[model samples]
Target: MTRKLTSQDAEALAVSALVYVANDPVLLPRFLALTGIEAPAIRQAAREPGFLAGVLRFILAHEPTLTAFAEHAGVAPAAVGEALKALPTGDDRYLAST
Candidate 1:
């Protein structure tokens, strides 16, 4: 049976995505620009609400990054999209969840 998703699971996905972004040579810049977060403050920025989700969204936004992360995370690329929908960020527009 598929496990019911929880907030923690979403957070985990976001965190993983963030880590993926950090290590990526290309995606990292996009993350900084999109997030308006400086490289020095990544750890602090990661603590912000929706920040993790944004990381996932960033990955989802790019086909290459998404594919790479999916391969590294051992999840299907579609799972990232599903995770985005499962996670709630209070911002209805970007929440992805219905």
Candidate 2:
């Protein structure tokens, strides 16, 4: 039976995604550029709230990246989206406008 995905699992996936991006010459620059996070400050930035969610978001935004990551991680591509929901701010609920 498949185990339920928890916040901890999602966090681990996000961490792996972060590492995947960090190690990629092309993806690392794009991630840093988009996140406005310095390469040197990545460890510190990872500790911040919603950072992991952002990492997932980054991976999700790109189909090739997501596919590569999912294949490499041995998870279904859809699992990344499921894992996102397990993390804080992953719901992406927009406040109703007045």
Candidate 3:
């Protein structure tokens, strides 16, 4: 059977993709601009896979309250929200410090 993709699943996939791309120095700048994440912090986080995972988790957990924040940050609300939902479930450590 084909499993359907939930909103959360979409979000996790989006985040994983972003994390993977952002870790690439060539794409990091564009990714940071698109996500509105601070460059230095993102660069530092990119070095650690756990940090990237945690950031994704944090984004997911904060989805409900991110609309205004995302708008203010000049990021697309849908994109940010979707990315948030893409966070991995059952990983408390990743979501703890995001």
Candidate 4:
């Protein structure tokens, strides 16, 4: 059965996707610029529950590359990587739920 999506789950999905995309070497920049979220912000957001969900929503809607996602998110590539690392990986169910 499909599990209901919690805020935490969404954040995990965002983190997982972000981590996966950040490693792509193509979508990193785009993700940052679109969100206007820097490394500090990314790190801070990771601690917050809903923030990552919003960021992920924007990213999924835009489907930007790593560079584009970075640019779009306004976060540095390194920051994105750091944030992605901080996030949990087990909650990836959000991807299919969404």
Q: Return the top candidate by TM-score.
A: 2
Point to the candidate with the largest lDDT.
Answer: 2
Kindly indicate the candidate among 1 and 3 with the higher lDDT: 1
- Candidate 3, pairs of clashing residues: 11-85, 11-86, 12-86, 12-87
Tens digit of per-residue lDDT, candidate 1, span 1-98 = 66755667767777888888788788888789887889999998777767776778888887988898999988888878777766657246554545
lDDT order, best first, reads: 2, 1, 4, 3
Q: Residue 31 in model 2: shift from native, Å? A: 0.3
Runs in model 3 with CA error above 4 Å?
Answer: 1-3, 34-36, 40-98
Which regions of candidate 2 are displaced past 4 Å?
Answer: 1-3, 92-98
- As a TM-score, model 1 comes out at 0.80
- Which of the two, 1 or 3, has more TM-score? 1
Number of clashes recorded per candidate: 0, 0, 4, 38
What is the C-alpha RMSD, rounded to one decimal, of candidate 1? 3.8
Q: Superposing all C-alpha atoms, what RMSD in Å does each candidate have to the true structure? A: 3.8, 2.9, 9.2, 10.9
User: Per-residue alpha-carbon lDDT of model 2 for 1-98, expressed as tens digits?
Assistant: 66778889999999999999999999999999999999999999999878999999999999999999999889999989988888877875522456
Better of 3 and 4 by lDDT: 4
- lDDT score for residue 37 of model 4: 70
